[model samples]
Target: MVSQTSHVYRYRVDAEDTIVAVDEWWLAFAKENNSLDLDEASVVGKSLWSFIADHATQKLYKEIHRFVRVTGNPITVPFRCDSPTLRRYMQLTITRHDKQHLDYESVLLRAVPSRRLALLDPIQQRSAAFLTMCSFCKRSLIEPSGWLEIENIAIKLRLYREQTVPEIRYTVCPDCEDHFGSNRQKLESSSEQPPR
Candidate 1:
């Protein structure tokens, strides 16, 4: 039998690596129920999921999502689906925000590195993926690598909405074009320098 302290230690290590925050209520519940049995790890594992489903507050659920995103690791547990088994288990639940309330009906349970739902159309995705720019002209150019012109392209590109392109015209203000041209020259010169 796994001692309660041992179980908690193991759980803390595992959860720390993946989950961002641990729920105090859930931790207390586990400690009280003596669900820390290694021999009956399977039962305890399933019970944990049930406990979360029944008792998890909205804040706790949101914390779990934040944890997964920051850590990039999946939650695990100790149960098998088909026959009945014991090892260790992982469980996760995600809720989407509705206009006024959280929609829990679409909860999902799986390993980590979960996929974010697609919020942009195909054109938007493609444009976002490939669009670059000419600093002088402010033209959006589809390039093989990624967006150019910006010092930190990936970070800056994230600021723009995929569906909305910045207004760049032939009649752009002369001063703005001059500023862009200077930036372009700097970037070009930097690229020409050999790696340090």
Candidate 2:
């Protein structure tokens, strides 16, 4: 049986961003999260882009990858990978292994019990309505205010009263985009050579 106590998950990708390898902990985490499709046989040899659901997040990741390869420096960033009942805070470090490969290491910073949110449950039934959720932070987009946490979204959107929750559509929020955008610009300017 895979250990749930393993807090570190790592994976390696080729220069083209094809998944080449994954640590056992990664498979264990996937299984724990009920993501059976992310098993080794299904994930390995697949393009990383295929796993990212939104274009904006993909674009940001591409920028980060380019920056790392060009500068030969690892980039570490904090992100949330929450489950229905747990709020998992994680840190990811992307290190260039060589000219042809890069390693991504994710360390679980912490996890706290959270109120069960149907919207976050993978097997939950969905209504025709859709909610735009930030891919990085997992916050739902509440118009006018933009992005808000699940708790606030629940009250503001009155999600608890619904018979079925809206389907979540992942996208990068403006805040996340701006944050990565500025970092990308800084990295590009600092790099002595442009990305190939």
Candidate 3:
């Protein structure tokens, strides 16, 4: 028997076991269970396998063998492509048995988003604001606090003129704030003075 270990987990297969064929069977099994989305199917299947691999009983193994025997058909799961060129179109197929002994036809596949994504239906547009750096200080748009400050600054700038007192006071380090305040005072004084 061939056995493999991943971290704390151990997996064993019979000497004649076909890993590739088993993968195909699982893929087909997922489709039978109405899990057409490959990513979701994979996630669920992997979780299930991890559980089974760790604590699989003889009964559970026999049940799985029965499932494969009854289905007798190739299964396919759809997967969305992360690639820009084929971003939304792809699928993966799995069969019950080895390819060489092909009892069933090749599994058919088509891309479909996961059920979770379908439920949420998030906007597909990318946010330019998230991609760009902060406009005022060239700081990267990283960290939750930085993002919050950026949002606050944008809102404040839009609602008030340059001289208007800020409604929402921003907290900066005392040293930095003092230096900035001094620079502002110098600029104002320079503007007020008459040309020499």
Best of the candidates, TM-score: 2
Decide which is better by TM-score, 1 or 2. 2
**Candidate lDDT values, in order:** 0.30, 0.82, 0.30
- Which parts of model 1 are misplaced by more than 4 Å? 1-8, 12-41, 44-47, 53-59, 71-196
TM-score of each: 0.18, 0.89, 0.21
lDDT of 2 at 83: 79
On a 0 to 1 TM-score scale, where does candidate 2 land against the true structure?
0.89
Which pairs of residues collide in candidate 3? Answer: 28-75
The best candidate in terms of lDDT: 2
Candidate 1 pairs with clashing backbones: 20-67, 74-112, 76-89, 76-90, 77-88, 77-89, 77-90, 78-88, 78-89
Ordered from best to worst TM-score, the candidate numbers read 2, 3, 1
Candidate 2 C-alpha lDDT tens digits along 1-196:
2322536799999999999999999988888887878899999999999999888888778878888898888888778888777778788999999999999999887777777766777777799899998887778888798789877897787765465889988898877777677686666675578655
